[model samples]
Every structure is written in structure tokens, then in C-alpha cells.
Target: TEADPLADAVAAAVAEANEPQPSAPTGPPLPGGEKDAFRVAVGQCWNVGSLSTDALGTTVVVAVAMQETGVPDGGSIRMLSFSGGSEAAALQAFEAARRAIIRCGARGFPLPVEKFSQWRDIEMTFNPEGMQFR
Candidate 1:
């Protein structure tokens, strides 16, 4: 009887441990209503078409580090990762992502100042295939 009780407790513990747990949010979700704002801000500043006509189906992950002052450090914006249709496409993706930062960074991302703390670091995926952010 004692062994049966012990086995049941062990089984229950194992099941509890195996139960799925929600993942922690990687970075702050763009505040409500700011999604469009962020998109527009990046789009207006992004000019990578000339950089890579071959980057038709490429995606680049850009990481932006937000300072407490609501401004991104000059060297904080960088390419975290990328995927492309080809080797050349991958290069183009990086170029395009870099250019976006150079052009749009001077004015700082259009992120709301109040929410800067939430997005201390933002890893955004730029998908040129659909010209959308993921």
C-alpha cells in the first residue's frame, strides 16, 4: 500500500512537471494603436529596394535597443538574423535592414516615448516577401 501511494505521487509530480507552461514574452508587444505607427515609421524610412532587387523573398531580423530616454543607442540597432532565397538575397536582406536603421535612426524609431521602457530591446522580423513586419 505504501509503495502504491509513493508511485502515484511520483506520477502526479511528473505529469505536473510535463504540463505546458506559457513562454515569457521576448520583448514588449507594441502598445495597442502603435502597430500602424511603428510600421509606418519603418516603411517611410526604409529604402532598400535599390539595395537588393534580388531580395524578393528575404526576411531580416533587426534588433533595436531602447534606452531609458526613449532613444535607441546609436550602435544598438543591428541585424539579429535573416533568411533569404539565395546567398545574394541574404546579403541584400542585411543591407536593406542596415539602411533602414541608418535612414530612420536619426529621428529615432517612431515608438511612443512612454512605452520605451517596455521595448528596451525589440527584435523585429522584416519580411520583404510581403513587405510586412512579423
Candidate 2:
């Protein structure tokens, strides 16, 4: 048994080398949340808004829009509008805008209409005509 100490060492090394490395965490889960690509797009859009604000506000806007409109462009427009409205009016406007955007061709996913109720948050009604929401 003592005839091959070097062989045992080599076997151990091979075993260690063959073991899989731990994968990097892919960040938090995102089933009912915004996708990563969409988040980056939203960040780029927010930077263009010239507003000094926090991520939470931006995140809320993006999430509500995505949940309501599905189209990236439409969601951004709605959020921008909702941001400036009074709280109560904004919520009402958000619901109205969501219905409008859906009617205008924004599609929902993962839950469909019956399952996912339209968002009625005050921060969801940014609709300026002639501006691009595509």
C-alpha cells in the first residue's frame, strides 16, 4: 500500500481538478420582475431624463410600466408622465394609460390579462403625444 504515495497524490489532484467550480450568482430572480436587458435599457433612458433621483423611483416606474404595457418605449413614456402627476390623479391616469397602451398594441406576458391586473400606481401615466414611445 505504501508503494504508490505519489499515485495517491496524483489521484487527489485529479479529483480536485475535475470538481466543478462554483458558478457566479446570476443576481436576484426575475419571473414577475423586469428582465435584465430591459433594466439596462431603462437605466440608459433615465440617464437621459436629466432628473436627479434614486434607483427606487426609477425601478418602480420601470416595473409598473413593464407590468402594464410590455413595450419598452410605451412603458417609459407612461412612467415619465406619471412621475409629474399628483398621487391620486397619477394612479388613475396610470390605469387609463395602461388600458390605452394595451389597446394600442402593447402585449402582456407571463400572466396574461385575467391573471395580472393592470397597474394603478401614480407613477405610471407619462403620455406625451408626438414623442416616441417605440
Candidate 3:
């Protein structure tokens, strides 16, 4: 049986074309000033003074939707996931994280406007470990 070179080339071309194209360029996973700074800002407001022992032991990921003015949409704040503790503990931790954002968010974050899309939908992690409890 003779190999069909044309058929193979056509298949390869179709496969390449079907592959998804890369989206716009974005920042690296870490060390990028914008994202790092954003996290730091949120962390600065992460108050853990009244958190319970179990809550303090848990870690959670908070999902927040942001407005164009750098303010978070109150209704859109939710806990996406958690670890290191029970569901009850996670809820407690999640509340702490939510309050943090709300507290410091009164005046809105100072993120750049042009990069709205990047910070528009944020999923931030809250780890109570290693944090100073007052």
C-alpha cells in the first residue's frame, strides 16, 4: 500500500488550525508587581483577631467580582474552595476573608484602570497559618 503524502499534509494542517490560539499576553505566575501588590493590599486588611481556633487553622479561596472603579461587587464575593479544616471552619475563615475585602475596600483598591480585566475577577487565597493573632 502506498502512503498518501497529500492526505497526511492536509490532516496535519487541519489539526494545527483547530488548535486554540493563545489569548492576550498576561503576567507571569508570580513576582509580578501588579498581582503581588494586589494580594499584599488584600492581605494587609485580612483581620484575624476574632477568628476561632478551627477557623484559624483553615485556608480558603475567595472569589470576588470587581467594578471598573476598583471596588468589589458585594454580591459577587463568594468562597470558591477551602482546605486544612472542616466546612464549618472554612465558613468562618471565609467570612474573615470577606470582611477583610469589605473593610479595606471602602475607598476601593488602587489598581490600575487599564488592567481592569486582569483584576476584574479575583480568586484570592486566605491562609491563617503564620498570621499574628491579636
Candidate 4:
């Protein structure tokens, strides 16, 4: 089959989206290292008490587009993919993920204003394995 430019472009875009993000440039380092800072900021509001056991154990990758001002574009928040549970359970997990982002980030994350491009969009994996349940 001949190479389709549109297909190739879409594939490249998908590949770039799935790749891990580069770390922030050197300056004021985030409190818990560069990468983990994103996690710690959003993870604090992840309340799993109401989630099912299956949901709590599942990992869901959530994606969101952001404004330059550090606020996540509300309509862009969505679950990209999930595993280790039924779709129903994954939905539960995704809701928790959504809540965490919306709750803790209502005022927007404390990302550096100058480096907005670095975080204009992000996909974060919410894995419950490391969380401590009550």
C-alpha cells in the first residue's frame, strides 16, 4: 500500500502523545522532584473511599488540555485508557481521577507561568497501588 500522508501524520501525532513528557527545565525545582510534582499535586484529592475494590486497584490514564494560566480545560478532561478491571470499574476509577483534578486544581496547579508550554497538555496515570486506604 502506498504511504498516506494523513495516516502518517496521525500516527506520528499519536506516538508523540503516548510518549512520556520531558522534565521541566532547570530553575526552581518542584518540591518532590520534577516528575512526581505533578502526581503529588493532583493525587492529594483522590478520594477512593467510595470506589469499588476493583476500581481502587485499577490504573487509569487520564488526559487533559490546559490553558496557559495553569487551569485545565474542563471539557478536555477524559480517561484515555485503563486496565486491570472491567470497564464499569474503570469508569469508577476514572471518576475518582476526574474528581481529584477538578477538586485540587480548581484554582489551577502551581505550575510556573513562564513554562506553560511544558504543561499545556498532560496525561497522568492514576494508579491506586501506592495509595493507602482507610
Model 2 lDDT tens row, 1-134:
35698898999999998886533223234444543343333322322132223311322232243444444245444544335445654455444444444444344333233322333222331333312244
lDDT of 3 by residue, 23-110 (tens): 3324433238877777777788888878888888899999998887989898899999999899999999999899889887878888
**Best-first order by TM-score:** 3, 4, 1, 2
With candidate 3 superimposed using the best TM-score fit, by how many Å does residue 52's alpha carbon deviate from the native? 1.2
| Consecutive 10-residue window with the lowest summed lDDT within model 3 | 22-31
Candidate 3: Cα lDDT at 124: 87
User: Which runs of model 1 end up more than 4 angstroms from their true locations?
Assistant: 1-29, 132-134
Clashing pairs in 1: none
lDDT of each: 0.67, 0.39, 0.82, 0.82
Off by over 4 Å in 3: 1-31, 130-134
Candidate 2: lDDT over CA atoms?
Answer: 0.39
When superposed on Cα atoms, how far off is each prediction in RMSD?
A: 7.2, 13.8, 6.0, 8.8
